[model samples]
Target: MTLFRHFRLLPRLVVAIVLLVMGVQPLAAQQPLTRDTSFTVASALRKARKDNPTITLAQPAFPSTIQAQRNLTYCTVGGRPLQLDIFYPKAKRSRGYPAVLLIHGGGWSSGDRSHHAPMAQQLAAKGYVTVTVEYRLSPEARYPAAVTDLKAAVRWLRTQAGTYPIDTTRIAVWGFSAGGQMSALLGTTNGDAQLEGSACQTSRSSHVQAIIDVDGTLAFIHPESGEGDDSRGLSAATRWFGASKTDQPALWHQAGALNHVTAQTPPILFLNSSVDRMHAGRDDMIKKLDAFGIYHETHVFPKAPHTFPLFNPWFDLTLEHTVAFLAKVFPKRP
Candidate 1:
């Protein structure tokens, strides 16, 4: 009996020693988070910069020979001046070129135009005048505030077309996550008076030539309301709309992009990751698009997580697919 007890104690002591060794081990000995495959955007940017030093945060200097400028304009939302960043491309002819406006996503509480500078620069490099604009976030400005700013940016872009190399008729809007939802709103609810009354009302057309929505939510109604699908928890909607799921079901529905789709909506490219939670809303939006017989494409990637735009392996693939989609949807004039 004593010998058996000693044997059991010996195994326990060995296990304790192993735990101690692991606890004292240097962090360097542990496997690093896969640099190129990190799901976080910051990590991806770090890896991207490591791989290509030229992908810096700074925007490229305007080419002196091409004739270009960087301008900021203030659009009022509930008596506050929200600023926008415009990158005008230089053109040889007097005719304006197509323009693409980008909206950044931060769950409607954070994020700014600077967050999307790299993508805007890429678009500018592709021969399109690009504008990345900032909008008011929640707890300060609520629903329709961000949407209003986006429409104002469009109107402002059109008004400044002569000064900038922008073709008002060929304008397009691109966004990620929350921003994507806003872009979908702009594309589908062009005539909605409540949301478009301010800056968008006077514009000849609030309609965009095309829309690029990246893994954005389209419905406010919880997908799991009835079946205990806790996946549709009210966290995101509550944050953005400032109301509990049970408190304002009607308002939530009204704010949903899927609720606003119509036959006249512009062509769209819906890009999402297979593992993303918002893919359901994206699917709903696609269904609406299908019901309307609207031209659109859906590109879903396997194993890519939500907000994959901020990472590398997936981001690289996203860029390739986006470029191809853009070419297909908005081909350059011959």
Candidate 2:
């Protein structure tokens, strides 16, 4: 019996020896994995800033140091496919790079993910993996729908971390206008089940480590907010809620980013125009942020418009502030 057992095991041992000699990895040694490289956005941005200390009036005309992977379908809503574009740094990082989810502003009505592609590329070139996303718009879908879609995108990004050179722990969101509102909500509403829509990758957390709001409203109830009805048929906010402010005041309050702030809320950076009425409740929200001992910063560009981040001079300044803020909040790994 012992001799018979030895003969049966002989073939397996011989095969293992042959594989080792031939340098063939056995099935158990193979893994579904992505190769990591030692490259980072922080190091690249630092070098870029040092090489060119002057801020330019327009996007640099030179070849981009990033690679753009366009139109990746991340989720679907109402049978419509939602897509996101990813910008990858040319330099490889072994530990992976911090990520930013860029949401466009179109009053929750218009605008597409492509709107922020240039900015995404710019950030990617500096060593970050940046993505621009598309969400359900108002009139077609009401309040929380867009937020849900955005959250789903976050989950999708997290799920793909293993396949991409991304640091799942250091994801952030940046938005403009309506997109800023969504970004603020994403930052403050982390771990809240109510806002996590029934989108794909539902098991993952949608929480972000940092948020950058460019002229996005923090409080809709504030008198200065332009979202409420102004003797018009219905305010944009009311339309978004699918009910008038008088009918859904609770929903209005729930949608306000200020309502969700707590010590657990991620650090935020507000970039606004000196005179933009959209940021009416900023002071009050800032007070809350301070009370909660959260780190926050505000930069008001004098004489700039609400869409200043889209233009030069202001864009350069915005980028400067953003780079500094992100560096402090999500430092690169060695």
Candidate 3:
């Protein structure tokens, strides 16, 4: 009996020995959170160009060593630690770098920070300090909860400006699908107290210098338009808002990004599919932007679908426009 028991321990010992011999590092250690400080943008861009020639839509403009710090806790909501992944250039500079808060899309219910990590990586490689954040999802928290989380994340990033090579003053927000709606709101509601959530780091401004909305709904109250589209049933918006338009008409209107647009709103870039129904109030919003003399641009991919931003060819095109816009809005530091 004693011999058999000792042999049982042998199996565990063998496994431990195999792990030791293989030099298996801890999960966190294996995937380092901090970037290697010595890398630079120029070298990284050069490598990216050489390795990914096909992916290049334009000349590789910004060359920087991109470093990603994953799963950094930004806020605590409902006892859950809301996290964000920060991707920044490793190149050392006197001044901090411009940043973009990249939000993922899943109809405000299913997406997480890592959903858009590839895009974030691309942006980072181009010298922008990009952050992909996780917000409180619907079925977990409702309407303003995600918005509030995003606001808090903006402030949190500002707070960490000193730690990472981030320029707090030149932050932008970019979102896809449901994320687009959130980003639009952030741009339109710069100083609105009512939309701000009860999260920590509220002292800092949640305002962004620019906004990029990719196929996201601007006005949920507007009837769906465009061909092959019958008036549909309850949308993700209705579910997220927790009520139908008829039940909460005021809320629906209030949630529309167009309703909040003003002179103070920042420059916006809209990238959308030709046949997407979510672009209900885009024309009207552009009119307001024109009236206010606010800088705004739009790109329509005639053949691409609603989720084109997530795929290739279109993604490269998206990045080309995005990089151009970022350069114009927040120029590279000397």
Candidate 4:
């Protein structure tokens, strides 16, 4: 009886040993949760608004403190023009202004650059040159296409440093939802050949100095991740990855920001909502960051919706943290 009981641990040990010898790191532990698409920004916002009728989207449009430039062609992919909108502070800094690129969230399928316009406008007024860029969604493009488009956007933003007030060295990426995941990836995958989208044609680097991930999952298949459920037979992540997690485990793993973390990863700030699933892989990623001495910060809104940044009180808090983080990470120029 004792010998048989001891052998119960053998199977687990054998698996770990085999993985180590094969140079394979196992996936992050899986978290059990019922999948629900109601966590989306739109659905969450509706309920949140019903509870507080006074809640409104952040910032008024066409603010006088900032000068706006729209529809600037950033990249041309096979004759399809990709555009980005830039927000510049009316009062220029002689030493060049630190810049931030804002990416919007839409489950990699349905979102536009304008989704982050309010964020860009407000950030620009705070003396940071801000840009909101458009990327190919899954409806038309696939996994790497979105990645490549964002990288190209970064490159384009860099190339404009000479033409604009941007300080090339002090650039950051801030994103919401799916955009948030991409934002983390941008920070971790800096200089990775596979992720460096080549459509921009510029030799300038697509590096970001910091990352702001607003309720984005760090890993798609982790114990904390809410992705790959397919309960409805077609989850959003599936559309983005072009297949089910079971069918393309490696590709799903590739898109995970947690898998790419290194000592070189830039400082990151996470602003999360009430959804536990959206907090996916964040703690584990932070552990890795700590191990490498990388700077990071996190804050969770007790009951705020996933799209809280789009509304007032939560938006105000988000802006406060964002500005402070940027100020700390990017030293004042002039």
Candidate 5:
């Protein structure tokens, strides 16, 4: 009976020996695949949908005079179809316009580009070519993938400059929360060879003229003591880096926007909610920028949540402020 059992296990042992000799490792020796955070984000979307029943997945109603295009398909990020909605002023306007690229935030895991369609259309109506882009989410795609896709989108727009009536020299990036982090990174690390190589190799310029970071995490270095605990929680860093605070310190810092700041960074506009839990490190980023004498403006909205710019009253005010700020920075062509 013992001999019979040994004979039965001989084939398995032979296969293991063959794998070992071929340098093929078992799945157990490899790192487990990361779980997608999109499920949780999808749940939040469902809640938002329920809470705001009137918020249909429809294009913003722009005036007929303005040429608004919806669901203009863009490239796929990691095999997933990504897209952007473009709003352009009519050609008869007799002047080219600056462009604004708006990125939506849902913790880097979820949020459609269309979330900012209304705002984009509003900007377009104000004579700017507005593009809201879609990027890859976490777990499915990891750190730098989102940033790569964003830079790709920028390069794509630059290629279409003449066709879209965009002022390639004056392009600016704007985002809320996680999107803000990406925009800030895009502004600061414009010339980074690693992040900008794959997608933007043909592009000579990576300089975004300005940035608007709304209640976003600017620094990856967390406070020594804070109201929100990093214990078992989801954040942009965790989602992108795929490691806990204790597990991967080096990667966390590498992925941080603060670590990449340089004097060449474009002028920045930072809008924050006074009551937001993540406000501490953003001040550190401002201090770093100030140390470098980089141009910047900041606004703190009292008694508001993290992404207060998305809600009404505050939303209207933010748009107004953004328009005024952009006008001051990138004036319309005469």
Candidate 6:
């Protein structure tokens, strides 16, 4: 039998797979968590500095090697113009390059697209057209608004398909935390009109060929989920869902990526941290993926922080895994 057949029984099996394939550290060695821990580059860096004070936050160079078009308005919703940044290689390709939409995660309320600038620049330098986009957060809008805004971004990409150095058919979404959940949903629900909101009025499709979900919860109602815990003084999920799980159970389930997965869903890559709660419904989703014979890969960095993708060592590894998976899913043209 395949090692993945017993996904429920072997949640840590992913760690072993990654360790053997990538030579990453063992799962037993994890960082210690604190009481008042937060999930942000700035907040995590403070704790990471304890280990390596010299470690600095990743920043984009003023005159980067790659070409960058920053702050281009992609969509206008409710008088608020949503913006996006595009990064492309200096040498334009006649056939265009694969594009990746990088999404930032801050419980769906706090982060901006700028958090992914460094990552977009690096991917551009490595021959991919990358985009970082802004969406209406929970404080600004609610539930489907963020999803609608993201789909609008995809449509915007289609509008600029031939104009920019991007291959519209080979686009993908890579997101972290809350953005991760959105990414998975985007991948699974390709062309679902309900999520394709009025943020943009384009006939283009929001179909992503691939998805990379980093530490995003797939199911909010699952036993593994840590969302909607009012004991912590208004959890992130509750705020974004607009009510308690008991108050609006259907909405909570509607937002879950696990419920949306289908045989037609595109390939997916799950990059995760040590936090079990973050891996909510991941194994189950993989079961569905496996049953459908859909392509998927899951890599777990045991004992790593929830926001490891923003911090070094982990960030570098994340990029390595990302590039490798993208190459396998969408091979470069000869």
Give each model's whole-structure lDDT: 0.68, 0.81, 0.79, 0.85, 0.73, 0.85
Each candidate: RMSD? 15.5, 15.8, 10.1, 17.6, 8.3, 19.6
Candidate 1 displacement at residue 276 in angstroms: 3.2
Which scores higher on TM-score, 5 or 6?
6
Which TM-score value belongs to model 1? 0.74
Stretch of 10 with least lDDT, candidate 4: 28-37
lDDT of 5 by residue, 272-329 (tens): 8764545446777788889989878888877655546655546766788788889888
Q: Which pairs clash inside model 3?
A: 40-65, 41-63, 41-64, 41-65, 42-63
TM-score on alpha carbons, each prediction = 0.74, 0.81, 0.78, 0.85, 0.77, 0.85
Model 3 per-residue lDDT tens digits across residues 15-55: 55555678864343454233222222233334445534443
lDDT of 4 by residue, 275-306 (tens): 87886999999999999999999999987878
Q: Count backbone overlaps in model 2.
A: 6
- Where is model 1 more than 4 Å wrong at Cα? 1-71, 199-204, 222-234
Per-residue C-alpha lDDT of model 6 across residues 1-334, encoded as one tens digit per residue: 6644664466586756756677676657555322222445687678867756665676646335688888999999877798999989878688899999999998987777888788888888878989999887777778989999999998898899667888888999999999999999898888787877866756888899999999998999999998999995998888888899999999999888899888889999999998899879999999999999999999999767777888766877888899999999999897
Residue 227's lDDT in candidate 5: 24
Poorest lDDT segment (10 consecutive residues) of candidate 1: 32-41
